[model samples]
Target chain A: MAGTDTSKEFMFRPTPAIVLCEPQLGENIGTTARAMANFGLWDLRLVNPRDGWPNEKAVAAAAKALPVIERVRVFDTLAEAIDDLNLVYATTARNREMFKPVIGPDEAADRMSAHIGAGQKAGILFGREKWGLNNDEVALSDAIVTLPVEPAFASLNIAQAVLVLAYEWRRAALKDAPLPFAGDEGEPAPRGQIVGLTEQLGEALDRAGFFKTDAKRPTVMNNIRAMFARAGFNAQEVRTLRGVVAALDRRHERPNPARLRKNDDEQ
Target chain B: MAGTDTSKEFMFRPTPAIVLCEPQLGENIGTTARAMANFGLWDLRLVNPRDGWPNEKAVAAAAKALPVIERVRVFDTLAEAIDDLNLVYATTARNREMFKPVIGPDEAADRMSAHIGAGQKAGILFGREKWGLNNDEVALSDAIVTLPVEPAFASLNIAQAVLVLAYEWRRAALKDAPLPFAGDEGEPAPRGQIVGLTEQLGEALDRAGFFKTDAKRPTVMNNIRAMFARAGFNAQEVRTLRGVVAALDRRHERPNPARLRKNDDEQ
Candidate 1:
């Protein structure tokens, strides 16, 4: 009852079933269930698991994935397992001479999402842990989904493979999921604050005889104002920068009175 | 030298370093290594692994990830671990009260790719297995990367988290990886073949008295031709369809000469 909220959220949203074909290890099955649970995928179908159904080893491995394990449907054959699904993507590690469209995990997720959105049943087929999906199993699928792993070490553990697809599927389902939190930087400093800071800095620089000539004063002041405007500083940052300018101006007044007079003379 | 081709492919391409902070389990580190290797990532840094470095358990778990494990760098602290990296992303499962830009794995991967492409170092900081990264550790990161897992079961294994990020990074790095194989459907049937099939079918339909009225015959024939054109039949399909028509026509001839005479009388 405690974790039923996420399950409720997944109720109406059409999700792709993860069908494992002839999976050998129960631990692999359990871990795959866990990975599926992590990303909100509940439907898990097994086609002739070697260790058989109701495996204690799988149950033990599936820590908090009881719901997924509880609903696991074991079938005698791959066709029977995916009989009701309208679309199936067979995942493979190797390239065989087949005339199907092979796609990466991201695009596969997107396609699955669109298919599911259109009220069509969709699922992805994963093969055995050791030998992988046979050519016959792949031929049964509508398309092939492959991860872009390094060619030398492309083999992924069964659970790891499920995790990547589940993650992608969840992301695609969410469409443009907003970031969890955008820090409290709220908004940039308003124009009034920026203008005030710019004018204050201008007066301080003028007092310090920073302008070499009267003719260039407006242009230099405009450039300084433009710099402040370009920084896109938040309120806190603007306050800190203004404080820094005031501190420097104070330091100039206290440390070099003769230098200021000389600069004024030149001006 | 046997598997050096993939490493050569990664020579100049910028990749993200995987930095695990105070990872407690050696097996997790090992699996992380395997996952990184699967995705063409080699740089691995550890901030004081609990069981110490050069862990036998880790080595045993990393099946074919010797390169990643052998090149593992251990740092005294998180700062030292990420000190050289120009961009760092801290991965978290929980939504903390921090004010950083929280991004999903895909966007994070793209940003890291761009950062690395600009000749700047980038790394992703994964937290401890049990507790995860502290606020201070997250603060050091330029942004936060969170996976869109089910809220009820948001906890992901350290290795699972690494796999998702590594998978995303590889996909983003490749920009647009061609699918492993596009089945050889060859080219669609040539227009000449289509025309031949259409003419054969049209002759068969005319012989069968499918068009009842003389005035509507042209419109019905045009519709039939348009239907064939819309089907986009390939060479094999066109041949099969033509054979089907010929079989039906042959059956019609054998069935009854009397029925043909009756149809002719109606026409």
Candidate 2:
């Protein structure tokens, strides 16, 4: 897909607004914007940046993701930043025992997708660089999203947190199921047809006396069947194997009286 | 393994040492130390810090990685930092036309491990915050480690750079052989033992008249051999399978034709 087209279709889908409340440093803000850009999330709302609006350092630090910072909306308060969002998820490392249900990044992403699809604007609020969101700030959100980090050191950089959440969100939004059997997008043959083909192949082998020497004939045959089943052979693959076996059988139809001698020599 | 014992055994094991050249901020140094810890590398040499040695900010920023900082040795200059090192690699975004090879972090890690195994002390030099190592400093190394970032914005924070290189180094150092098959450390059973076991199993099957169908003879036999081979059966595993086969054969010695038919039906 072309970059612009891919962006437009999923671009600016704007499932969640990233609200940075009183961000301390320009470099961190820039990195956070860059992280947002990774998941195609560009709608950023800044609440009282320390270095002032349109900070040069933030823009410089954004690197390839400067577009995200350029398009960010400046707001005076966290409430103003998330005013248009219907569903808000406040991110924090602290376990405050807020009555709201807590979820991980992936789960939050899944919920975010459903909410956005239902035409609701969702927002994720990030606290300042040093201390995370305050009690009042976290209480304002509909739910809380907490990342699982080492209990001894649960603190994560603001940008790293944004990146983790964005990655999960993008994966959920862009996932597609793998194709079955035939390869690519080909239609999968029915299970009954595949099993029937296996039986046909087995019978042909039986008529050729392939199971003569093996004492645990049933176990050996079952194992063979399991192998074919694991391969998930479609109708065509089974037919191909059968044809090759049939051809071989016809070639070896005339049994030699010296077959037992030849078998010993081969061993 | 006990951490200290494992650490001691591999203490002198050669690794790529990270040398920060006059790093200004303690937080960056702390983060860099944290990155080094991630890759199981504890050797850190700091070239004169602007804020002086053992900054509290660095310790706080390093968080749980204070042990790394505790062991860090401060130096007066780049030469002093790497005087004892046999191979030195300096990181730079600039593509210098010097004769030394320029490699990515992964490649550098691989090379470092190989050299380290040969008992060579390898070091990587990282420049300061404002102005990276001057040309003189860059010229002090054997090779340059550069992260492939966008050409428009290639500058990465010192700690972030350390994180990437450290990650790649640890991955290379700990790379193990594919599993289920024991690696080089474990002794494999002799080939004769495996073959003898297969033959015993095959003889038991032959006595049970498993090779009844002529056409299936080769396929069935070959499949049986392949199944055992894929299981990577050791001498013990082969003996166990043989015992199971013998027991089954003993039970079915009377060979009720109806029972045989039922076994086929079960399959």
Candidate 3:
């Protein structure tokens, strides 16, 4: 149940507490906790949940997110809840009727990163499941974090809201490590291999009378070279293409009209 | 229940079908529906759901996600569900045993958006909750959608995965809405105002003994101006910061013993 003990890769980084304000149902809270846990966030704070604390419904909903559920900090008021934090961002999908500085999820995540880097506490305030953070709560927040949903139907589920924000936060924090690309792990085929493959292909094409006109020979060679260049053929692909050329060369060398019929039709 | 009639804002856009392959629990199906609703998606096709169709648990969990729930389509296999779609992306966290083009959620969303823009159908495959899409099923997809989660704990819950992918899809689809910034709507501060603010700040800092060395004074002043130049201060923020500087300047003009003692002690 400990914060650092449970968090996986981002255990060292400071994560914002998810404060649920006056949540009506226990199921949504459980679902929200699961969403937070999915993104490596554990701190859960509840401000005046309607059904009160220690609801079994939330526990039932949280499958492997029991750690987040166990350490939930219940608060009597929103002010008392956020007083310990240096910064707070109120989340609302609807365009509010207030003068607060509104920020998107990415920018909000960046600000959270900056704050956490400075060792300052930051939190995201989620309003009641029915009505989002009220005007007064929005006024208390330093800035507003709004999801970039369509204006026609911007109503996001509470758990969905938490997931989006948590996803952005985790992405911003753990962004230094680049994703592993299987293809990029391999080195590009060497110049020698490309040359060998090109020569073999040229020989094969020449045997098939591909470069018939002397005037168009240079243009055709350039086109072949450009095709190889654009293909970015790896060593294995180059070897396979070379084998194909060899197979074609042997067939063209031999008077096998039945096998050469496909090549002739393609040409 | 129809795709166009139900899809909230993106009615005109070609929406992708959410194909769940051998989903075990009905509750997860409900949660997935809720998540899809949050992103304005209504097309859901279940390929061999364990509990069969018209699941009461799914209906109960999906709060006001009636549009997605009502229009749910049941298929006998993955092939039949995705036969109508021109392109399909398989969502998988693990590096599969098969060779397939892996793309992050954002890029997958972009490709989906592009396909939709070209009047082509695209669908995403969600595997079973316990075990993800097998290699044979993954091989059927044109590309794989991998979430950027920590490799240590990359197992995201079925609904969490759905929300993340759906969120990205909606973001890529309806990206015309400009992100809300406090200063983006306002005009940027004119060069004249920036110069005035820079001079004002410089004078205030100088009075407060910011530039201790005569030799470094010009360099420091240039650096300060450059900082302001890079800030891209809007008219309102510039005036506000200038006001703050002016207030500080007034307080520093006549240094009280207490303030001077604090400053001197600090130095």
lDDT-superior candidate, 2 or 3: 3
Better of 2 and 3 by DockQ: 3
Q: Mind giving the per-residue lDDT tens digits that candidate 3 earns over B1-267? A: 011123444332457889999998999899888778767788999999999998999998876577789899999989999999999998876666444667777789999999998989999999998787888888899888777654433557777788888878887887776742232235668989999998898888878888888888899889988999987777887889989998889985666779788999899
True contacts kept of each: 0.40, 0.00, 0.14
Write one digit per residue (lDDT tens) for candidate 3, span A48-131: 999999999998877557657888999999998998898899987655655466887878989998898898999999988777
**lDDT of the structure predicted as candidate 1:** 0.83
Candidate 2 residue lDDT tens string, B122-191: 9888888876777788789877776543233344678766766665675567565221111121223466
State the lDDT of candidate 1 residue by residue for B114-213, as single tens digits. 8888889999999988779989999998888888777666668888888999989988888866643455554678999988998898888888888888
Q: Could you give the candidate ranking by DockQ, starting with the highest?
A: 1, 3, 2
lDDT digits (tens) for residues A95-117 of candidate 1: 75675667888888998899898
* CAPRI level of candidate 2: incorrect
Candidate 1: stretches off by over 4 Å: A1-12, A180-183, A194-233, A236-267, B1-12, B195-267
Docking quality of model 3: it rates as: incorrect
Candidate 1 reaches a DockQ of 0.26
Question: Once superposed on the true structure, which residue ranges of model 2 sit more than 4 Å away at CA?
Answer: A1-29, A34-65, A71-267, B1-14, B177-267
DockQ (C-alpha) of model 2?
A: 0.01
